[model samples]
Target: MSETYYLHLNVSRFELSLNGSLGQSVNITNGSDPNAANIYPDISYSLLTVLLLIMIATVAGNGIVLIAFCASRRLKTPFNYYICNLALADFLVGIIAMPGFIVYNLFNEVWPAGTALCTIWMYFDWHMTFESAINLAAVSLDRYWSVRWPVSYKRHTSVKRTILILLATWLYMHIAFFPGYLYDRIVNVYGEHDCFWDLVMNRRFCTAVAVLGYYIPLSVMVFCNWSIGSMVVKRTNATAQDPDVAKKYAEGETRLTLAKDKARRQRQPLITLAMITVCAVICWAPWVIYFTIAPHYPTALPDILITVGYWMCYLNSTINPYLYIATSDDFRGAIRDLFCRRSGQTLSGAFSMIISAAPKRTSLETSVRRAS
Candidate 1:
């Protein structure tokens, strides 16, 4: 049901031009015409089913995280403030990016929504992706500062400061992705007006975007995690050597118990953040590298690799809420409380149980530490 358009190039001049449906035209040199080959092969029904499932999971999982944040007052701390923002970004990805991608793939890369929607999709795709990356980086920096300088971090990272940081993160991403929004153009590919960035024409700019958006944030995450790991190891060794600290805690010293409880609370969020960072790198690194290098040798890479890489990026947004449930007991409790409230259990009752159980869990953990 789709139309096909072709651009015949003069071999001597090697100029390629596309005439879009609305009479818009685009010119390029030394890049393969997207319509020149079968860039979008017919997808199998089974693969489509799998992709649909992934899309559903992405939407549902992030939605639960957002719901948990909204329903649980206990989750409203500054640390989780960043987490809520991350969930929001991921939720938007599920709401906007994934469905459009499913449609694009379903129709053999034909953008059914026309030029304006294409432009909007491209903008949201890049903007939300960049926003997620910044959020991850922000979470890493927050953890790094909180762990390395708890008192200072607590003093400075107030609710107002967290809001400012979130605002700054969005502003930075908007500025970073503005060029992509501006440069995106629609071209007729096999009779379908496709919206895409003209970055292939300027490989340098594409490389710059990838380096700034992916590599720098990735490097920051790695350093922060390494620093955090080193601090944990040093602190663990110190605690192991210091018998007085263990004795004080065992003897039910109020100050030491409070300190241990504070550390325990901070530890769970750090672990959750670390898991998210690892997942983000794994999911995003492939596409960033592929995109950055693919422009140089566009035909060298297969279409399936591009598709796989793109889906992998989307996969990151889907897994974060699961990571929270897997890593953080408090998050699990909050989610449970949210669901259990319908069964007549109040948040305070659930929290009280959690508070009452903490001492037993702590005692068991302390015993395990001594045994080790």
Candidate 2:
């Protein structure tokens, strides 16, 4: 996955790695020509364990997001619907993609799962990862639009509109980039026991995949975040100059400290989406670079780096919900409702419990109070 078609969805057979601990490298015929394909043998059990944990986290975290959206009416906004779409993608990656990949990597000798299932795994693995980036872009773009034209955005936005956007995104990703996967399927015939893909033909298609999945989405998110951030700063400054408040502040020495704090706060935007973009760059950029340039350059990046590059995307999925909770009131309230409602811990319930615990006034005390 790392050295070749990104995720190496091209897994045919894993032979002895660089150290050559196994008996010998296995050679397979790519149609007329036979070539030696090396399966990375040093499968770090600790890393695999961590990946398993990430997969679990991805599933649980995204699942919580989905449930939170469903459980609370407060979160039923158009933007939240976009977030829920991303969560659904991350959830699918966890439940369907990660486990399949982890298991595939675990059995380094031969793919126990039938080749047909292997093909399906390959398809889903790329599709889910691509969907995540695309969805993030979509969500960021939606936020930018909402902020840029708040009144119009609110007037036009609806759950139905969000659903349509999501549907379009899903369809576009599937239909536009499908030929790449289909090409791999057609060019690299699967082994009876292995799912190794011959990447010679994939070189042409890898760039397109990288562009659609990584570069374009990355650009979109960055542009959207930048636009929103600029607007936030301008709006904050404009509102802070309110004539009455400015006059009051100008007359007071104590207001100097408050102004400093307010200025610091104003320097930052409310949307922490920039952080998400940073995380995406950290997690996905290496793989994107490799997929785009590796075929032509053939530079051997460290196994650790490659491992981090691919799995870190899963790590992003794991942390996405918590990050949203930090920045989004909707997510926070929805999650609070999800947990509190299930545990019977609503605010009204707390108040009732407090009232019930108070000592009752006796009749004598009541009569004395009345007389007083």
Candidate 3:
């Protein structure tokens, strides 16, 4: 299937054209015509700028979260263990996928890095998505066990189990991408080559993947969220009858709030598993809709809407670190300790000044390297 697609680089607002069949590039352009009955670059540079900001925040925020979780001895718990995995997944995707996307968009959809890089982009995009989905499911189950079987949950939920789940998430996501890579080949179309899963002609196979990769996982996530949420509400209502905890609730106070404050005093993790699930839904709902619906309607509006949907998924990684900081008192204090020692510090200038002040770390220093 030969088709043309455009990628808009946020920094410079350059548009690149791609041959959807070969996953290669033909030429780049400044912008697409908005009113020519096709996809439009009607969105302003300011909006793109905001996206770039969001991307940067996601990378930096997740980076800090990873560092804090790794550095602090007190922050390690069963829930935090899963959160660390989530942060790692988000950080990897942000670093690998976002820059490549910026390059594609800035150059106007032309994938100058060749087919191999295209594979990498596709892999990172799908792999991280799978890991995130599984992580959400795992977190939901974790919460379910915690609330419904509190005693058993305390006995069974351990660092070892968390490790097993994290490993399983990685293994599952990598294996899932293998089939897409094996069967899907890049082809040249309309005088240019592009990379995709070759779903244009093989609608059956594409539909299967959509069902397996997206719809099924979405359904699972929805079920887990609903089950866990219902249990939490019921558990809270039941627990309200207790003497100590109930007395607090009867005094026009939220038990969850007091419980969190008490948990903070002990440096326990504060983010409820329910909150994490909600964030996942908010960040992924748009992209999932776009993915499922785009194949059916290949109109300009769908294309543009799907592009927006892709960015919305990225927003999850960007805002998750902040969520941890806001919800978890321990994380907030760790961050404060990380930078507060430096007097007259400004949040905006901290990263920039650090880069400028310190000697740059070579690629050798970082073991994790992305192909693109």
Off by over 4 Å in 3: 1-48, 186-193, 242-271, 296-301, 341-372
Ranking by lDDT: 1, 2, 3
Instruction: Give a tens-digit lDDT track for model 3, residues 1-372.
Output: 665555444322233433344544555443574212222334458757976887788889899998888777777878888888888888987888877776666545555566777878877876786787777676667766675677998887788988998898777666655565555644323212244444454444556666656666667767766775676567667776667775555666576687777645532332355466677778778877665555666452445665577777777777777887777877787777766744336755887788899997788765555543
| Runs off by more than 4 Å, candidate 2 | 1-45, 196-199, 244-272, 299-304, 345-372
TM-score of 1: 0.77
Best by lDDT: 1
Estimate the lDDT of model 3. 0.67
Error of 1 at 363 (Å): 62
Q: Once model 2 is optimally superposed onto the true structure by TM-score, how far is the C-alpha of residue 126 displaced, in angstroms?
A: 0.6
Ordering by TM-score: 1, 2, 3
Clash numbers, per candidate: 0, 9, 17
Per-model TM-score on C-alpha atoms: 0.77, 0.73, 0.69
Among the numbered candidates, top TM-score falls to 1
TM-score of 2: 0.73
What would the per-residue lDDT of candidate 2 be over residues 287-362, giving only the tens digit for each residue?
7766666667665655455555667777777777777777775677778777878678677788898999999999
lDDT of 1 by residue, 1-372 (tens): 444454555322334544344343444433465433323446688988988888788888888888888888888888888988888888888888888888887766667677778877877777888888888888889889988998999788887888899999999887776765564442223234454565466465676677667777788889998899899889989988997877777766787879878878768887888889989988987788678768898887677876787788899988987897788777789888888876566767888889987845578799999999
RMSD per candidate (Å) reads: 15.0, 10.7, 14.5
